[model samples]
Target: MRIKVLALSLIGCCSAMAWAQQKEPTKPAETEVYEPVPPKVRVNEKGIPSDAIVLFDGSNLDAWMSGRDGDAAQWTLNADGSMTVKDKAGDIRTRQEFGSVQLHIEWKSPAEVQRKGQNRGNSGIFLQDRYEVQVLDNNNNDTYVNGQVGSIYKQAIPLAMASKPSGEWNTYDIIYHAPVFGKLGEVIQKGSLTVIHNGVLIQDHFELLGTTEYIGWPKNKPHGKGAIRLQDHRDNSRVSYRNIWVRELE
Candidate 1:
């Protein structure tokens, strides 16, 4: 019994010594990843990244087409490097389709302030032509919280009201993720959106339930890449847009 006890103690001591002598990580680089370096992207004077695809630079409507009949865009191109909605003409959309992307766009309401509420400067930027990020001149105008400026139109209300003055240019920086669909046309992963309005964080990674609908429940019909659509509102709201760009993501 004494011999067996001595043997057990030796084995325990040997195990403890082995564990104590094992080397631990000492430098940060020991676990740092150096491969797969990201490519360089130069930002221009206008803050546009080199890797981005400029949808509109205030020059022409080359990247856009009418959303109604796939005809030429009927919006009015302004002398000030902007495009104004031609009332009743139709909505316009990008010719190229995209799945997930980072989008930057600047918009402004008419300086005259013709109407109020949803009738005043009502427009929207639709991601994948399905989900809407509402645009409204909510400066002193009151409306439903879910349909206000920067809201994900009836689906997600913005965290804050981050609109600029009714006529001044307001910027929207949006990061969007496309939904993944299963083989049976069901949603595997829901989409998400992060929006920064006029330099303020309005939507913080909000998961989308489905399409932003106006008259019924949100729907999740399976679809692939879709174009970015700009609404006309068809109410003579006269919303103008400029400096639009996008960066496609994997």
Candidate 2:
């Protein structure tokens, strides 16, 4: 099945090239740069590619509605187009729901050192607002290996700590699969996650034990398509995010 999918993707790419070539020879030429984009890096290309939705590009968060009241994102947008957490405004989730999504999120911790460890810089990008892939400054600081940087919250520990220092931006490139529940509320297909933290493979083919937590074990409850959420830990962490985008997979 995987090989078939790969073949289909290659065929699609070739067909796209052919279509471009047949349309208007006077148009500008297309080039393959052979560049590998690291995690959380933004792609500035235009138009939809298959099943996807662009959330942010340092332009506006109008694509986001308040997870609290279905209003526009109230976070502070900087001159550079990044969005900062609004202290106590809680989290902001996408108004449009998603099932299986490829999420791209880039975040930066505080540069000035006031606290240490988790208190220093902590935040998360929540898929479906339930399962959380952690975000913290795990560069060299010591903390719980599982819950520190790139673990699936508290359930599964990361393969390695791939984090930059506080203040430097880090990225999380995640491909998330939502759980499939039956009529009796039994999960037939437990969700799975693949995360690349800061250009490093941390959680490769990790099965989610349950929803991420700070005080308890994971619990797998039945769910469906849900909104993507950015956490608000209610500290002075001053976490910033940009280049937020997603591609829904069927």
Candidate 3:
């Protein structure tokens, strides 16, 4: 029994020595993996990398041509670097084409508060000249739910109502994926959009139903490349737009 106990103590000492020799997990070689500098992002609050093209940066509107006859834009340039709708000068659009885009636009209704509903600072940012993600002054005012601020205009209502009072600047950072179709004009991959209205997410990867309209249901028009149009509703709402930029996607 004495010999057995002596052997057991020896074994325990050997095991403890072996364990002590083992270096405790020295904080795994903290090799700093410095990532490469990301690309220029137009509107990526999520820190995603992107390439962008600046349209209007309080500099010039040369990137945009008239929606009427391809001449210079007719909108009046505000002293604050914003461009106001010519009221009856029709709409303006970029001269380029885009498939998927990260769009950032800043706008505001005239301080001189206007009429109510549909006519209250009514305007639109028409993507691909077809899909209209609406822009309206819905502060304490009501209108058609699906056609109000941050709407996919007549298709899907916003996930929330986030509109600043009139005159204050409101912003929209939109990620838009253009539609994809099969041979039979049937939608294969429907377009999706996520909109941030005034730093609030109002549209979250919402599927588009088709082009926006006033008096009818959504329709799937054939796809190709199209311009970005700003609607001039002919209501003299004095819509202003600034900080316009875009980043194309493959």
Candidate 4:
């Protein structure tokens, strides 16, 4: 009788312990306590934040240089506070190097549509001078969806086509998180991009696989902060840009 009672008590104790070990529902971990408040930034009519680094204010290309030959950017500066890409001038890149940033830029394809498919307005916005966010004239035009405007080059495609007309200006607000490199020059963490094209979210924190190569497979060349380059394309697409600025993220 005593043995039976002890066995019953032990089983009850084990059941109680098991019930205590089970997880109970609770509130989520609070992260708001650890986050700090960001500073306020006053934006101008051009939509450039006060803390932003004005790359092109429709005035000059002083902040840019030739990406191919390291010479001064040979793109044409117009009177309307915009710069037109000069055909065969090679690519132009920012003289300053940046990592994670919020970049704002406006671009427009030639009013006179010249070619079709990839040959038309075939420019690109390169992050870290390697990863490309295509800047093609995808308005009423169709090509490979992966290489269209607002795409993460040949890697991630856009969520939707949010391009304006050929002559109308289109804006790109890009949030880029640069890749992290390990000690042996290997990629520790891949980069990511979130793009808003004309107030519409196109690329939503898209992960970058590797370098945006035109041909062959994508390559991962471990690099630090790099210049923001614009492709020349040599297609005479006459792509124009204006009111470019960047705000570094902490």
Per-model TM values vs. the true structure = 0.89, 0.78, 0.80, 0.85
The segments of candidate 4 whose C-alpha lies over 4 angstroms from its true place after superposition are: 1-37
Global lDDT of each candidate:
0.92, 0.78, 0.84, 0.88
Per-residue lDDT tens digits for candidate 4, residues 150-239, read 898889889989888888999999999999999998998889999999999999998888998889888887788999999899999899
lDDT (Cα, tens digit) per residue for candidate 2, span 94-126: 888889888888898878765677776777888
Tell me the tens digit of each residue's lDDT in model 3 across 1-250: 3443344345445687765675553443332223344555453673333466777877678888889899988888878899988889988888997888989889998888878999989999988989999988888789989999999999889989988878989989999999998899889988988999989999999998888878798889779778988888889989899988887876
Error of 1 at 32 (Å): 0.8
Give the C-alpha lDDT of model 1: 0.92
Residue 91, model 1, lDDT: 93
- The candidate scoring highest on lDDT is 1
What's the count of clashing pairs in each model shown?
A: 0, 1, 0, 0
The candidate, 1 or 2, that scores higher on lDDT is 1
Candidate maximizing TM-score = 1
Which residue segments of model 3 deviate by more than 4 Å?
1-50
- Candidate 2 clashes: the total is 1
